[model samples]
Target: MAIHPPAQEALTPPAPPAPDRLTGRARLVLLVLCAAQFMVSLDFSVLNVALPVLGDDLGLSRSGLQWAITAFALPSGGFLLLFGRIADLYGRRRMFLAGLAVFGAASLLATLAWNPAAFLTGRALQGLGAAVIVPTGMSLLTTTFPEGPLRDRALGISGTLLSLGFTVGMVAGGTLTDTLGWRSTMGLLTVAAVAVLATAPALLTESRTPDRPRLDIPGAATVTGGLLALIYALSTAAEHGFGRGDVQIALVLGVALLIAFAVVESRARTPLVSLPMLRRRTVAFGNLGGLLTFSMMTTVVFVLTLYLQEVLDLSAFGTGLVFGVQGLASVVAGVYAPKVIGRIGARRTLSFSLLGQGLFIAALLGLGADSGVWLATAAVSLASVCHLGAIIAYGLTVTSGVPNEEQGLATGLVTTTQQVGLTVGIPLLGVIATADSSLYDGVRTVVAVAAALLIVAAGVVATGLRTVSSPAGAETSPAAAKPSLAAAESSPAAAKSSPSGD
Candidate 1:
């Protein structure tokens, strides 16, 4: 007879809306960001083929040629964490735009360089610009696409283009140098940077941590110095082995500096990178998987390039063709990897892909002096399929469940693994290949070793990730879901406290 009390469902506020579809504008944003990443990667490889010509024209000594690369690698890998945190404090859009400009100007300098000094300066500046672009671009991507299938797919596409850019650059580098001259290689980067710079400012909205924290100066100096010294040692060792006095000195200095940085972080009010973030099962193991995949896969490419050219008597162009096939395979695998992650979860996908990549790399053990070029090509192509999957899955795994405010730091770690792995892996493994009596034996030994490492890494990642769920499913462990330092420090209560208070 009396009006019934409102139902409990009606008493509660309506449920929050689900994430919307990728808007027309979101697609544009993705295009611009991915373009920037592509340019960074393109520049990295595009210079490889032109190095000899550039050296002759600019009177670069053998040491100068090596410096050309080391100069770039040093800052690109070293400054990533520092710049990432800076972007989190300042505006990401501002940093990103500035990076594009620096990269463009540097490319122009290299294009017109009249001497070795000028060319080296341009290359070094390009690396510094890349350090800014990589993390900022990746952070922009994760913040823009809310976590789920949408984010997974976006990362997949980005991964596809990134790999493609490197491969394309390798091919384009040789062609452009031979046809248009060596300067065209750097000129290509100038054009690509300008294109991305033109579009990015329009689509990207500014994003950063709400509370601006003081920069971590001590943490920055120690980590950046550590990375620079570490990369220098490894890069030098790649050419001269570990016995050099400089390599030994740099190695010791790097280890000591990194240890000091750890001590600094434990005591700092606002650490550059949160120790807890690194400890997260997903973050730690995800990055490990990323490091192994990138290192081994690139090593495989290096070994095959030698085998193709030195052993099989293939020309440079023919070698490029072989890699072109592998690049296509990567594209196909990247396109479908998101769907796989959606089904099995990123953890499983990462582990399985690493395993697959290992098995295919092991197939290269069959390559011989008389072996057909197709054999090496087939092995690399198949391995690349798994490589691309691992790349996408690793990115998804690393960035999953991270808060938007700390996306810059998280992506900084992602990109650090990527750049360091690429830079360090070749040199580390190249030592093994060079140490053996014969080139063929050395390559065989290297592949065997790479396979072992990949398999071991797969086991380790699988075990670490056993209990964790995928971001696609929106499930994660309490430890991974816990607020990171940056997030915690932003809170009113945490502002008055420090890490020891916990």
Candidate 2:
């Protein structure tokens, strides 16, 4: 008797048909994911303007008050990679829902905290929730939408909301703190979390890699510790000069541990971040561009905030209005960013936007002690447009052409770049601003450095991404592909499987 080979269906599954346009269900899914991300970004800066009032209410000391912010930053930036991988292995939907629950509970805890310790604990827990939410939410978005216009447009909207959330938080935090109280800020996050949680379970689908890899405990420990130490060092260095012993020790420890992590990953069979993945031009240079854009733009914002408050003597509320305008500009730019990416490709768009951002930032050199606020407003508003473009394009560049199996890893790196840059940039550049004898001179010098870096990064990204192609078993140019409606016939099985089908 002769035995027949395995049937074709058993060997190879049919490719999922990509949707030409987002269906009502798909659109709802996008909304919930973006809302979750927006909440994460809002928390990053919402408390900043309220710190003074929050401290007075909780009777927190100056140094202790800083922990309200740092506590959140530490875990959110540190644990992103570990949580991202776990989500890929277990289930994105499960991790996302879990994160939302944690974030909501922490926000409520923070809202009710009457003492420094309680508030700090709540903030730290919120950070832990954020670490899980950001990466998993992002991976879900990428997997939900096929790698074409749909994903690009979704990312543009998502990126815009993330930036808007921070700006809105800044504005609203001040308004709410002055009117209602500091507790209202945290309460706001709680409400947002609840809203997203309500809709996410029904609309979103579960996704994960086909293979279940063992969790790399050693890799996770080193990376998490290294990031925590690095962020702590930077935050401390910004306050007390880097000459402090503890800061020096932390910096050294972070670098050393990160180096060790690299070595361990090289040897691990199931590495948290595979060496080949980093070798990909799109991932490497794309994240490099992301780090540069997020870091420099945030640093510029920090300098401008100082300039507005100290040099110009504007009230916190007024300063927030300035950023609110920038946020509006970001919204406009985000609306058009996907179209730009479609026409020129994500790589070219990334380069062009960076160049534009650098030029506008350079225009801020005209700012002086008695200069009108309009200059900063106009410059940042225009730069923000470019900034939003770069952000959306960078997301597309980094995640485009990546396989569904590694979407978590890809998004983890993208978010790591974003969170680390946003968290670290202010401190790294704030130190420089404070070191100068003349405040105006220091601000100018910082912008000049930031501008030069953005321009340089633009060139580097353009060069690196020139000949980019997809990884094994992905479209050759997902960012550049224009999917035809006829080819985008709906597949019910694909809709059900969602990410796995893609």
Best-performing candidate as measured by lDDT: 1
Model 2 TM-score (2 dp): 0.91
Instruction: Please give the lDDT score for candidate 1.
Output: 0.88
> In model 2, how large is the Cα lDDT of residue 223?
93
TM-score of 1: 0.94
- Candidate 1: the clashing residue pairs are none
Candidate lDDT scores, in order, read 0.88, 0.87
TM-score leader: 1
lDDT per residue as tens, model 2, 1-502? 9997655345457765665588888889999999999999999888988998888889999988878888998899999989999999999999999999999999999999978989999999999999999999999999998877788889989999998998988888888888999999999999999999998999988998867989898899999999999988887777777899998999999999999999999999899988888887888888888998999999999999988988889987788789889999999988998887777778888889999999999999999778759999999999999999889888888787667778898899999999888867777787788789988788998999999999999999888886433332122343335543323443455444544455
* Model 2 spans > 4 angstroms off: 1-17, 468-502
CA RMSD per model (angstroms): 4.5, 5.7
Q: How far is candidate 1 from the true structure (C-alpha RMSD, Å)?
A: 4.5
